[model samples]
Target: MNPYQAPLKDMQFLLENVFDANTTWQNMPAMAEMVDMDTAVAILDEASKISRDLIQPINRNGDEQEVRHEGSKVITPDGFKEAYQQFSDGGWVGLCGEPDFGGMGMPKMLGVLVDEMNYSACNSFTLYSSLTAGAALCINAHATEELKEKYLPNLYSGQWSGAMDMTEPQAGSDLRNIRTKAEPQEDGSYLISGSKIFITGGDHDLTENVIHLVLAKLPNSNGISLFLVPKISVNDDGTLGEPNGVSVGSIEHKMGLKASATCVMNYDNAQGYLVGRVDRGLVCMFTMMNYERLAIGIQGLGSAQGAYQMAADYAKERVQGVAAGGSPTGAAADPIIVHGDVRRMLLTIKSITDAGRALSVFTGKQLDLAKHGEGDVQTKAAKYVGLLTPVSKAFLTDRGLDATIMAQQVFGGHGYIRETGIEQFVRDTRIAQIYEGTNGIQAIDFLGRKVTGDNLATLSQFVAEITAELNELQHVSAEDKSAISTRFDNLLSIASHINDNKLTQPALINASAVDFLDAFGYILYGYYSLLLADKAVGHDDANFTEQKSYVAKFYMEKVLPKADFHLAQVSRGDSAIMDMPAELF
Candidate 1:
């Protein structure tokens, strides 16, 4: 089987033709100066080569070699340091960082494409740099200029890496329950004492130091405070000092992503500088959290694409018995690609993968518009970002996990073995749903913060947008029209019902939170598919347009109908869910 290939043609088609990302960037003042279609496409081509040649070579070896913890320092897999050196020398860690801090300052719309390529190359290897980019975002948004001056340049340039320290023993989803403590120092810094677990890239030899963004509570604060804690102390002149009382207790042995150093980090009087106000740490951290959520969602998509490539290649070569209804007198067996069941699996992966890519880019577009567009356009875009963020995160990762599993199954017993590497995709994709906030928490945030809080205003507006587009379709068949139109209606109506009864039906709403997110997720995918089909209907490449139409039809038939299953669960209320007693187990 050939190695995973970047879907460059499809990516270009979506960016230039379907999404018109070029136009979006052309109007944005920040990007208009530095980027255009030509520049962006060149960058994508370079990134694709990096993925295929440099990064992917280490993926399997990284998994097999994992990381070794020799006392205080963690040693990454062989070639990781060199690979990261290239990643750094290429200036990719800061692909979308602040330009003022020596970054390229690319738009997230384009950054998402780069991120997807890296994740496809090696999700674990990408984690080291991806976390740095995320932490730099938070510091850039909230840190004092002096702190930013000290850290941002190095973090962005790959001289230093970054980590987020929020997960403590007692605090997983609920940040308010965290026990990490921060005591004020006379020199305008804080001494942090905390034990954080599952810290990715918490410490490594890939860079000089790991700058940690830790969340801690002060002596008199009602809310948590954000702190910038470095593993090694940085002197006033921007030089390295001694270890700042931070050390790794141990790294967890996990099911997958073994190359990523998931550590139990102990900060004992670790010198940490405050970021933003003492009582607004969570607010500050959300800047980083939101960025990472979208990045992690892309991780799911990339991993799935990798698995699909492997399975598709395997099915063509590993011919066994003759396919059903094929010529019975054939001297050789037909490839499994000719079989219906295998085609169903392949189509399911392809349809969702395409739709997921569109969703990621669409959300990134909203983020850009929110940042740069004026007046009502900005407001609408920001609200759409909030409304769709959770759905994109949960749905993409949930489907990603499912897609990887299904792709592995296409290999039959070979999938279970390690040599084929399909099983590694399954193992790696599973963590995407768990980290970056579990998909369940994403749903709760969606139902509570985005949906119920807005009283369905944004949700209804989005549904209306979908319905209006459906109304404008030129030659949609009656069946597809009914399917698409009814889903749009169902989306708005169910949202309205939830809003109308959320107070009286809090229990029901809580129980149905995840289902509601899944239901809305299906609608969002359907809407994206519609947009793609509409744009491609009359394209010059008839074959490409025809393929787009077929994918949309497959989504409508095989995927969009899933909205019913989840929505029905939501409509059942809390009868079957909440009825169970506390001691039933």
Candidate 2:
């Protein structure tokens, strides 16, 4: 079997059973008649085939060939350009875009699932497409109608790609410090001039033109403004023209996802149009960022899934140590999966990845609700979506890196070899945690912004909802309910303690944010496993139910314990982090 199989059944279960995504779409008038189970399943299957057959073959090769920079131009690896053409031709770029702008108008939930599958097959190759989707989403929401009419169709169609240019030499995470400048010209256009670093898809030949959404400070503005700068200037007739002032100075050779073109973009008097109002650029940029943050989370999900596939396959085939029952009588050696430690590692990967998928789907559904649902339903759902975004981004990516590392460990010596592809998973997964606002920053956002700033109302409401779900499961048989309920309570108690204590130290809260993220992730996974178990009960498929039950039990017993450790540290407050002097470090 191919190593990158889509896990179609599992994805279907998540969309239909766990999230009831079909019903969610059905309720929304905008999406109601547009999508259904059959259509969704078909889309997923096609995306899976493209990912497995077209994209997967390029995964290792892309990493090996990387992106070569000669003078000013970048040479994408062999087959990359063709693969991108296939992707574009399939209209995959606009899978969830607006129909008015030539998109298929699918639900975001389905889009996320497709993205996860693509990322799993090959992260580097998938990024080019993912960023285009994100950039188009921003333009669709915030840009003027003229801009939308002119740019959206091409962007959605993948005839053109988009890149975000925010980070400068002086500004890494602090956007307030950006030095890029945009001067208004007599022709109502802006002359954007600055150097942007680490701009993914900055300059690539994959598409006809690269639309860059750059953040620059204007002379009259107090903060910053966003501008649309394309690689090649476009005429009023919608035809490509002379080269825009922007050029790729060079590309960064990264630790992983080598095929992804991380470039140093130089915008010297780049002909640009301002996106949104001048002072409100950051707000407009965040419209795209919220989506990117979630997409980055899915990146982690993909890495974890990919790593699990490699590890699971290795464990079943590699025979090393004897089984506990004395080599099964006449067997030469038992499969490594027979050992408890290996089982623990595999179970951890399964439990977290499964829950991560649920969380991603849940977030996607919330976005749908926020966008389409009515009145209070929309208001409440939108708040929940905002609250979960940081958690989903930070938590999923953090766990993804750990899960990938664990999967690598299962391969032991083989994992170190590039042939196994496990090391690449580790290297690739590591970036997810760092990017999309370093997981630490994400933690700070969760606690300082989401939890403390909001007086834990959002976090409390989330916990309340999960608690209510657990309460429902309590009515089940004692044996069936024990693991989930107990673990749920443990998770709830810690959250309550944090809320009740009213911890206010940002440093301490930030330090413990990652731990808090893990604790919440395990609890969330336990919730998902319980949901799966609840659905699997009395089903004729023993294999499905048995696997569900075993994984849930392992999660509650082995994974849930970490919540206590995290709470213990969180209880210590910020002194451990805040008390240390910067000079001392």
Candidate 3:
């Protein structure tokens, strides 16, 4: 049997029951008319069918037949181009774009669910469009009116694709070391030169033109700048012209996600136009970076969901052990689902995945509010988004990789084989931890910038909110509340210690950042799962409500305890990481 199934019911429960996205939309003017329960459900249904029916079938094939490069042109797998067109034709590309630019302008909350579905179906296939969504966000936020008018419509329609060109050989994470140069010309455009590596969808035959948001250091500029470098130069009338001086050097052969093209692009005197302000390329790129970071987290969520479906299904059918209740009368042995350890593995995957999805969707709601809410509300939402962005990026992806690995173990030797498909999940999920800024960098951003850096007001507010909820739950029996409350206190104490010590040393902050990220993520997920339980209490669906309560208890007892362990490590500071000599490795 195919190991893929759309978790539509669970997704709907999270959206309508836990979050009440419908009510949230009713309160927001910008999204009120555009999204309702019916529309949201319809969108989800269409996305699921497209993902399961169309995308999942090609997943293994795409991986097997990886993108091939011959001479200057690169070729996608047989069905990719047509599938991309189908995705575009269905208007799926603009699920969350601005309506003014020929997009549906749906709320990001809904968009994120669609993203998770698509990723779960086929991460490599979904990335081609994901990059477009991200690049469009950057352009819409920072580009000029003409640039927006000219490009946003086609981009939103998916008639044209987008790529973000930031990395070079020497400048993967360090933007300052980039050697790509943009020389200003008399026609108000800059001539871009240098090579960019690991450019996803860099040069594909999927669309008419590929819009590259290139990052290069311009001469006589104070710092790096962003440029819009298209594959084919366009005239003022929006007609295609000669080829821009950009070419694909080659594509990389990687461990997984081979369906997606990872190209090394060479720009030799390519005509380009500055995107944002001079020397403000980093700032503009960050607009895309922030969104992409969260999207990567969703990628993790997708991988976990995909892996869990396979493992859970296998456990329910494969008979290898005796049941706790006793051996089945007619069967050779009971299914592995009856085994405590196997159940533990599956539950671990489910509990973490469910919480991860809630956290990600919550963040997506914050993104929507930040963009469309009122003055102070918008500012507060924006700050909250900033604070949670890194945690979601690092912790979710890290857990996603872990979860997939555990799920693979469920299949035993079958998982190791290419035919079983579990190994692909492991490979596809692993990259989420490394890309979009390695989880290490994400942790540093969470601790140093979000927590330690004078942004304490936002962090404090978040803690107070969670504390209030914990206090309310305290009325429950002491035994019931102990794990939950202790986890909350542990997280609060760590945040308080970080604030109190005021460690100005970057080294210390950098070293302990991953611990901080893990602590924050676990505590945050615990809080969200508690909220889910609260919402699930009154529902008439006994099975669903009971599942929610069980997951909440599991999170408090099993998952939340990790916060204390992380805090203990964080309190020890960065000496262990810093004191290690380079030669010791």
Candidate 4:
């Protein structure tokens, strides 16, 4: 396997050229004094080094060793503890946390880039910190001031790691069905009693403590609420106390992410403090869920980028069939790079991964603006955040799997063997689509709640923005511009059709949701491709500019047509999907 290299050039290009992140940060009051282009570049450089030099070496070995369940504790693979110590000491877990709570308070724009590199280096290792950062974000957002002061600092400092406990044996996506109980106690605490399955980082030896943000029902009510339950209780002076009844039943033997502990966590009347108002746990949890959703999307993007690098590198070295124009190297057999099919696979991965990265960064910018911008800007950014979060989680992972598989195909039989390390990319990325809410659930959320809930107002705003930006680009050709515009038009029309019939059609949204989201993803990628091409026009690196233009052209010609297929499926309504009887199967 080729060594993992963070795409620093592309990251810098997106930050400085396409997104103009410095200007955005300068305008936001909270971030204006905290970060800028120089700081972001420095952070990215350091992150690249950490990913390539520190975390990547353990990826394959971690997978092979896997996490072990020894009696009551979970032991991570060799090198995980040391690597995590280095990671935490660098203050990386708090890169985007609030400064008041010992966080660096960087913008999400910079944070997302850093996350991609770490994930590219090692998915299993990166997940431990990712959950920690996300749990801190949630506590900072909704937890009381006392709670924040007590826990946020430790979490941000990485002395304590965090986990999210939401799923149960019977309840996966539907939180309403959870049977976890939190009974009120006399001392202003609750007794949390339940077992949560598939809990990532639930109980790991990586940190001094594991703080869990748990979801449970209040006494005598079906209303769900969020709580902060610690593995080890904390005293008033912030000293560690006795065990808090939080125990690991066992670690799940999973398909991938073996090094990251997935536990069956049992809270035996675990002493807990409410993070938010009663019966509103789901709402508060969304704060963390949204963050994890975008992070998971980046997980997919990072995997795809890593896989592409390996494939592209291999294609150049592997000698295979002759080129259509004959061998340029005059060898017995030209490199596989000369073959059209190999090029097609490589280009497919390149086009999608590049666009996906730009989109992830774009989503990150919205998250920053939503948190730090003024009234209208904040409100608008929040709406866009809600609209794009699910798309980012679903579409990016969907394409990520596609890219990884294609990259593996480039290796032929060699890809299937574990020694090559390409199959690890495939196994690791597969979970991104499954966890952090499955892609199917994400699609339903996108089309059902986000788009149709507002009667298309927010989506219309997004469409108008894309259209205006496309028209303003000076480098794109009219033909290219028209092709994207037509898809945009078709998207709105299809959305309007769904809106007009959803109430009467009942099953329409559920049946058409996936296709609609897929269509939007394709159209959005097409838009970003052109935007990147336009921004790359006069870049100091002429080769980089040409590559961007080539990818954009390829996306428009070869990939954008997928929008039509999905749009057609959306036009068919729910009749075909809902026609079959359940018993017939």
Candidate 5:
């Protein structure tokens, strides 16, 4: 297996040229005091090392060893404990956490890139830390000041880890079906009782304690609420006390991410604190859920990147039948990369992954503006964040899986065998499309709520912004610019068609949801690819700049056409899909 090298050059280019993180940071009052381009570069450099040297080395071994379930305790695989210690000790867990609680307080734009590096190294190993960071965000946002003071510091510092316990045997994407119960107690706490399944980082030895953000309903109330439950009790002085009622029923043996503990957690009268107001737990959970959705998308992106590196390197070295144009090296057989089919697959992965990275950074910038900017800048940014969040999750993971499968094809028979490690990428990435709210659900949310629910107002605003930016670019060719503009217009037309007819044809949005999201994704990728190329003009590194232009052109010519096909499907409406009765199957 080829070593996973963080795509640092492309990352730096996107930050400095495409998105201009320096200008963004300088403008935001909250971030200007904390980061500059040089500081961000240094941080990324260290993250790359930690990912390459520490976490990645244990990836294969961790998968083979898997997490052990002995009695009620779950034990992580070998080297996981050590690697997590170093990762936490360096404040990597709190890289983008609150500054008041001993966090580094970096921008999400920079954090998303760093996350890609760590996830690319090892998915299983990174889950423990990722969950912790997410839980801290939820607590910081909605928890009481006392709760924040006590839990935020440790959760951010990585001394303790966090888990999101939302799913049960009955409830997955639908949180309304949750059966967990929270009863009020005299000490201003609630006693939580429930069994939650598929809890990632639910129980692990990597941290001294596990803090769970659980969803449960109060007695006699149908409305759900959020609670903070810890594995071990904490005394007034903040020292560890006796074991709480929280216990791991068992660990799930999964298809991939084997080293990460996915436990079936059972809570029996566990003492818990409410996070946010009553009957509003779902709102609070969204704070963390939205963040996790994007992170999972990056998980898919990182896996595709790792698979591409291995496949591309293999194609160059693995000798196969002679190329149609003859071997460049003049040998009995040429490397597989000399074949046109292999070149197509590799280029497809490259073009999609590059644009996907740009999209992630763009979405991250919106999240930063929403959090730190004031007035209309903040309001508009929040709207964009809501609109882009689902797209970022669904589209990126959907493409991520496609890219991995294509990269595996480059390896041929070697890909199927476990030793080559390309198979792992496929298996690991499959979950990203399934978990964090399945891609199908994400599509519905995008089209049904985010787009049609607003009567296409938000979608129009986003499209107009992209169009304005594309019109301003001077380096891109007029033909390429026209292609992008045409698609933008086509997209709005389809959105309008759906919006106008959705009232009469109730199933229009639901049936057309996936196709609409897919078309939107391809169009957005096209826009970002051209934007990247436009930004790369007159760079000091001629080779890098030229490659960006070439990839952008290829994506425009080959991949952008995918939008038309999906749009055609959307035009078909729900007839073919909904006409078939469920009982027929």
Candidate 6:
């Protein structure tokens, strides 16, 4: 089979038509000169070519070869080193990073474009760079001038790589329980002694050094503090020194993403420099994690797109059945794509994937607006970024897993095999739902922190904004418009239900958080689908518009119904769950 093709047509549609990203950037002073429509197009085109031609070929090879941990070092599959060198040399690692630190300083909207392609082309290969970029972003945010000067350039240049050392055996997600220790030294540096599990790219052969952003507590600290520990120490003159008491215990033999190194990292009194203020480690760690959360969502979307392409291609060529009415002419069997059920599966994946693309890009645009937009625009952008982060992270990955499974079904028995690659997509994509934050936790964060804590201010305003956009739109079918309107109202009603009953009903929010998240996500995807359809109803690109219109209909008719079911669950409240006795079973 041919390598996955980047969906440039749909990407361009979202960038240029639906989002009007060019004008969005033109409004922002920071991006006007550097990233016009012309520049954005060229960048995407170049990035897509590299992803398809250079990176995709290694995906299958890496999966089969996996990563090997020998003695002190870990080894990646053959050609990974060369592929990474090509990536770093192209300056793609810093595509959206700081310019002062040797980065390109492009917009995050563009990062969504380039990253989606990279993940689709080869997710295992992409994880290495993804971790590196996440590490650089945290260090840039929390590190002092001296540390930033010392490390950011090398990270951006890809001469060095990076990792995050969190998730100790005892303190999975509960930071309050961490036992890792950081003892102070006279010179201000500390000796960090701890073990961190599930450290992605914790040790690799792709770079000269691995900079680990570790989380540990000081002797008398109230909470965890972050530290920067390098695998290979650095001298005052910026030269490489001896090992920093770090070692790889073992690499995981996993169900998927076998190509990416997931190491058991042991830091034995390793020398580490503090990143942020004392006991503010959660703040520093979250800065990197928030960035990673969105990237993880994009991973889901990418894997879905990859799986869809494979299944669609396979369905077209594999002939297995006669048409519903009769055999066409004298042909023995018709291609599976002719069947309505197969079409349903294909469209289910396509509709969700397309809407997912729009959702991801829209969230990225909010980040750009938050940074570069002035006054209220910036405030509103920041609000959406915070509100939608968990939704985007959870919704995309959950649907990504669903999409891959659906794609696998399209292949029937063939999908279960290892060599067909569809199963690999299923396996590789599984990690997204579990990592960054579990989908269940994301929902709790969405409802508890974002909704009830703020009293649904952003969610309310977003509902109003989309309702107004729907009012102004033309040429959309009334049925489609009504479906969107009714579902959104149902969403608000659910919110109101929680608000009204919660004072008398204390456990309502926690009990209903997951359903609320699912309901909100379904509504949000429906929102984006409507926007896409509004633009596509009568566009210059006939075929493209037709495809968008079709997907838009499918989403509203078929997918949005799921929203109602989740809302029904929300309406049921904690009564059913709470009524069950602990000893009943």
Please give the lDDT score for candidate 4: 0.93
What are the RMSDs of all candidates, in order? 1.5, 2.1, 1.8, 0.8, 0.9, 1.4
Highest lDDT: which candidate? 4
For every model shown, the clashing-pair count is 0, 1, 0, 0, 0, 0
Instruction: List model 5 lDDT by residue over 1-585, tens digit each.
Output: 767799988999999988899999999999999999999999989999999999989998988899999987799989999999999999999999999999999999999999999888899988889899999999999999999999989998999999999999999988899999999999899999989999999999999999999999999999999999999998877999998899999999999999999999999999999999999999999999888999998998888788889899999999999999777778999999989899989989999999999999999999999999989999999999899999999999999999989988999999898888888878878888998899999999999889988999999999998989998998988888889889879889988999999999999888999999999999999999999888888888999889899889889988999999999999888999999999997
Q: After superposition, how far is residue 557 of candidate 1 from its true place, in Å?
A: 1.5
Worst 10 residues of 4 by lDDT: 323-332
What does candidate 6's lDDT look like per residue over 81-156, in tens digits? 9999999999988888888899888888879989999999888889888888889999999899999989899999
Estimate every model's Cα lDDT from 0 to 1.
0.88, 0.84, 0.86, 0.93, 0.92, 0.88
How big is the positional error of residue 179 in model 1, measured in Å on the Cα after superposition? 1.3
Q: For model 3, what is the error of residue 103's alpha carbon versus the real structure, in angstroms, after optimal superposition?
A: 0.9
360 in model 1: Cα distance from truth in Å? Answer: 0.2
Flag regions of model 4 displaced more than 4 Å: none
Report the C-alpha lDDT of model 1 over 1-585, residue by residue, as the tens digit: 476689887788788987788888888888899788898899999999998999999999999999989988899999999999999999899998889998888888888888888888899999999999999999999999999999999999999999999998888988888889999989999999979999999998899999999999999766899999999999989999999999999999999999999999999999999999878999999878777899999999998888888888988887877878774558378777777788888888888888899889888888888877878989999999988888878898999888899899889999999998889989988999999799988998998889889888888887778778777777566677677778767766777787788888778667889999998888778877867777787787898789888888888988888999988888777778878898995
Error of 2 at 410 (Å): 1.4
Tens digit per residue, CA lDDT, model 2, 213-260:
999999966688989898999888778999998888999999998999
What is the Å distance of residue 405 in model 5 from its true position? 1.1
Task: For candidate 1, list the clashing residue pairs, or say none.
Answer: none
The alpha-carbon lDDT assigned to residue 448 of candidate 6 equals 78
**Cα lDDT for residue 102, candidate 1:** 81
Q: After superposition, how far is residue 410 of candidate 4 from its true place, in Å?
A: 0.7
TM-score for each model: 0.97, 0.96, 0.96, 0.99, 0.99, 0.97
